[model samples]
Target: MTSLSSEMSEPGANPLDTVERLALANDWAFHRQSDDELAAEIAGQWCNYKLWFSWHPELGVMQLSCALDIKVPAKKREKSYTLLALANEKLWVGHFDIWSEEAVPVFRHALLFRDGNNASIELMEDLIDIAVTECERFYPAFQFVFWGGKEPHEAIVAAMLETEGEA
Candidate 1:
């Protein structure tokens, strides 16, 4: 990866192209928004999500964000906050959040590369996997708070419960 940054420093090195190639190799559908930005839609266990990634070659950082389909009702904003706080606690790499302007839930994570380091396909794929898995794992919890009319604690507990003897 060290050689990669050096090559990028040359006249024409498009970081977004590296991202596009990886997305194609993985057979994931994606669109290039600009020279520095790319977006993709992925299907998760509970719902589909839109992922946006921006590459800052100067800073050697990649910012990845995923927007879940669930939206918190205006009336349930407080409950949503409590649930997000609980969910964010267990997540080590990324955290769940509510976008105040839209009242939508989002999961975000960032990858920082040291000087001379470049982004790898594996790293990008893993980041997306983590975000999707976390969102699916907690989808039911949010549903409980918003539609089931359950308190935050009750919602999480019920969502985490495992039932046996299924029909």
Candidate 2:
């Protein structure tokens, strides 16, 4: 099997710089906690999302997690897990997860930049776009399961339906 390190190259750049610039360009409220960490808040149709970015220079990886505003109660945790599993299955990149400490759901993904590969503004934009879109697509499912008393499968079905045109 080919090793990941072999496929990758040496890294020395920090991706948080790019992320900070992207956050500012969009006029989003953001904080640069440190050279390696940044946080931003974005408004969506359903609710606001908290985006956190961490850059690992040694590992040559940048990780992003976008947390939804909704929270999962202890009683609804099981159903939320099931819903997350179903939602993650439909995604090509990133996965949905419950942040246990905060009991909030988040979409997480990572980018590997090796051999002098740097993150472009377009790439950062796409990363944020995809995360928010996926969260919006499934926000109702979480609500359905927690408050509407719908089963995970049923909620998934309802949330996944696409309307072709406006009435």
Candidate 3:
């Protein structure tokens, strides 16, 4: 992990610039696709996450999608959708959704920088951290539903179970 600056970006600055800096600082695999787009791959405990950041300068909104490496098969899509709904209910910041075209689950969030307000580096860091953390936390539920043949609710319960102490 890389240490992020505590500074806030200047108003009217493209947020993707900050994102690019963060990606470089962390040594994550990344590409600056355009002035408004950035894509990065981050390795997590459960899987590698594909992160896409899109900056809409006109709207002053930056959208991020952190996608899991696994794809939900057609037969498992219904259950996966259910699991996504249940998982999203637990999140305070972002929500998980299955990208219909890709059949991949992604954690999505957006930050608004309209009205000349600045975006803090801490906020950007938190956005990435939260997305990865949520994805890691819920990965097993998807696995259980897809591969373990468990029901969505059951998978959620099983994945969310926490042991009391270290062995």
Candidate 4:
């Protein structure tokens, strides 16, 4: 993990790409809590086992919560995925919706940001990590479209400039 100032000096580095375009994001942090800890934390509130493990330095926090729904099939539901942003602020509420299918856990390769279409390869690893966590919770597999650093996905990630999302 290079110093923030180091990246700041680079002319080509995009502000939004800092966390999402990282090649070696060694500074990011992750944690795994036990069921006892969970029970103690959310004793009264409704409990959902969609656990979260995350790392967000520029966003000032890298917290993940299994405190939400996994959006299982039988009917499609939207899952709000929290993504950190560093556009002059530490925290930004970004989202990606996982719509349920006939399968219990089917993750469609859908990028949910209008301005986040370019240079997102760094997010791949992060997304993979999150998806892996989701898989663990749901006892299912990811309906992976571009798992091995491949196209449309890779093209969007590799581009030096931003592309259209939904405009």
Against the true structure, candidate 3 reaches a TM-score of 0.96
The sequence of per-residue lDDT tens digits that candidate 4 reaches over residues 40-81 is 111112222332334332332333332333333232222111
The alpha-carbon lDDT assigned to residue 2 of candidate 4 equals: 34
Over 83-111, each residue of candidate 1 has an lDDT whose tens digit, in order, gives 99988887888899888877778899877
- In the predicted model 3, the residue pairs found to clash are none
- Candidate 3 runs further than 4 Å off: none
CA deviation > 4 Å runs, candidate 4 = 1-104, 112-117, 140-167
lDDT tens digits, residue span 1-167, model 3: 68775887888999999888888999999999999999999999999999999999989999999999999989998888899889988899989998888999999999999887776777788889999999999999999999999999999999899889899
List the candidate numbers ranked by lDDT, top first: 3, 2, 1, 4
The 10-residue segment of model 2 with minimum total lDDT is 1-10
Best by TM-score: 3
In TM-score terms, candidate 1 sits at 0.83
- How much is 102 displaced in model 3, in angstroms? 1.6
Clashing pairs in 2: none
TM-score of each: 0.83, 0.91, 0.96, 0.22
Overall lDDT per candidate, in order of appearance: 0.78, 0.86, 0.91, 0.30
Q: Which pairs clash in model 4? A: 50-66, 51-66, 56-62
Best by lDDT: 3
- Rank by TM-score, highest first: 3, 2, 1, 4
